[model samples]
Target: MAAEASPAPYADLGGENTGPVYTQSKGDTLAVRGYDVVSYFTGDGVPVEGSQEFTVRYEGYDYRFASKDNADAFVAEPAKYAPAYGGYCAWAIGANDALAPGDPNVYKIVDDKLYLNFSEDVATKWNADIPGFIASADVNYPTHAPDEHFQD
Candidate 1:
């Protein structure tokens, strides 16, 4: 017997891509990930006064919130505030000359750990080696900012 096929795409990124989630309700466009104005997370959730910013605590030190709401309202929007890519290191993807976005599904939730990765593809590649592309990019990314990893 053969295995059943999944209807979803291999690389969904939880949304259309690594941008944000939006919905057309009654012919109106609404930002799903809250009304913080910034498409930080996966998008298409709800809107809170200050739930638009983020502060990913990973790799030992606390990465300061990039936005005011992310830092102030994370407690209220934990899932809505965490980065999509597990926070492996966005700069690394930008450096590798690959445009990769974080994979919400390919995430690591540590009791006191900040999950991270290069890109969703790289994360898939990482399965081959626990510390695969991550270690590689750490060595070559500084020389190049490749935003081509997460191509639609």
Candidate 2:
């Protein structure tokens, strides 16, 4: 028989994927909603739309880029561009211990690590105690890392 589908969509691709991939569920619009992850750090703190032509696949998920330079930067240092908590809401990870989709536009960088949030409100709260929240999320992350998204 085929393996049972997870109540959640989390999958451990193991070495096959090279690392953790963002939850690219079937028919999901795009990775990080097609926003250029590199743009958040390399230029003005804004979400830049990525093009389909300039794309790279890492960890079995496709990340689109606004330019070839951005795509190359990601290929060179993926950890520097990929968001923390597997692109889940940072506040939800620390506060509620939940997995919520992070809005690519609502983001922040602390200690050179990118963080995403469900909304401005959650980002605000997450900003209140960045260190504390980071500590909490750091602990919770490993437990939840294997799964891309959680239903409950």
Candidate 3:
């Protein structure tokens, strides 16, 4: 099942949300909607809900983990685990230069990086041309993404 998303709090930037990370709402610091990012790479390769007990702050966002080991793993190399494009829907950023909420339940690991999509349908579109989209997003994200966490 898809996780519930919080109401968007920031005003749209030309009809697109602009930020370095995708939080559910303004003033919310939880990354990946509190899903364990490390879990996406470890063990069964299935994402698991993180515990508040094991949380780490990185790049101005709070990342939760299912266990201390996972947290430590994240701390060791955050860039390795952080979702590409700050957890925004990969296809959206790549195809549209738009910031759409990335569903943790719908994810893909590409070139050893975790990438999230808006939904299964978007994932389908993304899967069609991964390399091309990545190239476009690579050029678009830096231009569209703001340096700050939240920009209104």
Candidate 4:
């Protein structure tokens, strides 16, 4: 999904990472698997490529947006647009409470929050117990970083 980051358009954003928990698989790269975090909420939940024309660097990682408006919206409220569990797989967060890279294409929006999973199979399991799993994820998320453990 157009995940490359461009340095020029991000001066407006205070160059920072989204959060301590945000996933930067392979050590360094763009956030949210390179998908536009705002699109999951505003659009049909389908992963969309973010354009370099509209980008921001929050916390430390860079995020791309499909348009200036979307980028502005994200800049206004980063926590609202950022994914839960450090953009790790929601199902993994709930189940194993361990770290796994969430597939941008496989996601669900619950309570206006964007949730992602490692795969379609895992997402199915997560969908079945949204409330229960979220409870687990909520409790387990803060203590550890998704990348701390090698296991998925």
Candidate 5:
């Protein structure tokens, strides 16, 4: 019998994808819909930018926070405060560290650590090799440099 060829060891080989990705910023706790940060599983979205409490829906999920302070706290340590994949797009992470938009449903917790990706297509690839790809991505991310990865 003839030998079979191995599949390419990449989430997205072409790396020609455009999508939203999880962003890490100082005050990024505010949800895309302008809702305050809250336990994805527990509370509804509150207005983190102000002291007022409000509710908002994202990706078909409802979230809430008691007050702006609570939302700020949640945003400060999202990995510890938000649900898995609740704040980041998963597929993006799996495929060449592409920036994926946040998906509240798709998530994974490895060694109690949270990571996010872009889309379901990207996520499927990410789930294939959690440790290996993540390690490589982490290593590659820092040294990727602005000019090499980004052209502004």
Candidate 6:
């Protein structure tokens, strides 16, 4: 299907939004770099690039989906699909409480929540101590993150 412009904003899907969902730039509201967040949980667990035609705006960010089904799934339960730590690099948030770009291609699903890392190398480090890092991030993220997207 063809893509379209993002639709009007929807109600803020309540969650402990650590920070603004990561986007390519300050003006960019596309979460997960336009990847289908729900795709991470379905099929082979490989995330698929999303189309603007299946977009949903939630929590001040626009999430795209590979299909209408995925979009509808997100609309039903955004917190379940939205990336943790506001789509920031998992390692950065967990280890340093810093905001770093999370590569959509490098991700993990732990305890049913999706987490993203900066790169393969970062993912390796993060994978070494997932639980520990999550514990640290769970404490650090809400306290340190500003209520805005990174001004890249």
Best by TM-score: 6
lDDT of model 4 at position 132:
95
* lDDT minimum window of 10 residues, candidate 5: 9-18
- Model 5 C-alpha lDDT per residue in residues 1-152, reported as the tens digit of each score: 98985332211112211222233342232333333344333334222332224333233233345554555554455446443333444444434654335544444556655554555666788788877766765554444333221111
The runs of at least 3 residues in candidate 2 whose Cα sits more than 4 Å from the true structure, single-residue gaps closed, are 1-29
In candidate 3, the residue pairs with backbone N, CA or C atoms under 3 Å apart (3 or more residues apart, or in different chains) clash, namely: none
lDDT of each: 0.36, 0.74, 0.82, 0.76, 0.42, 0.84
Report how far off residue 41 is in candidate 6 (Å): 0.5
Ranking by TM-score: 6, 3, 4, 2, 5, 1
Model 6 is weakest, by summed lDDT over 10 consecutive residues, at 9-18
lDDT of 4 by residue, 1-152 (tens): 88875467543556444233445546664777567899887856667989877767766666788888888899899889988876888888779967777888888889989888889999999989999999999887776743453332
Per-residue CA lDDT of model 2 for 51-142, tens digit only, reads: 87776666656677888898888878887898888787888888877778888989999999889898999899998998998899877777
Clash pairs, candidate 6, are none
Cα lDDT of model 6 overall? 0.84
Model 6: residues >4 Å from true position, as ranges? 1-18
lDDT of 3: 0.82
What's the CA RMSD for each of the models?
A: 14.9, 7.0, 8.6, 4.4, 17.0, 4.0
**By lDDT, is 3 or 6 better?**
6
| Lowest summed lDDT window (length 10), candidate 1 | 8-17
Which residue runs of candidate 4 sit more than 4 Å off their true CA positions?
A: 1-6, 9-24, 146-152
Task: Give Cα distance to truth, residue 133, candidate 4, Å.
Answer: 0.7
Pick the lDDT winner: 6
**Clashing pairs for predicted structure model 4, backbone only:** 16-58, 16-59, 16-60, 17-58, 17-59, 17-60, 17-61
Work out the TM-score per prediction.
0.31, 0.80, 0.83, 0.82, 0.43, 0.86
* Candidate 5 lDDT: 0.42
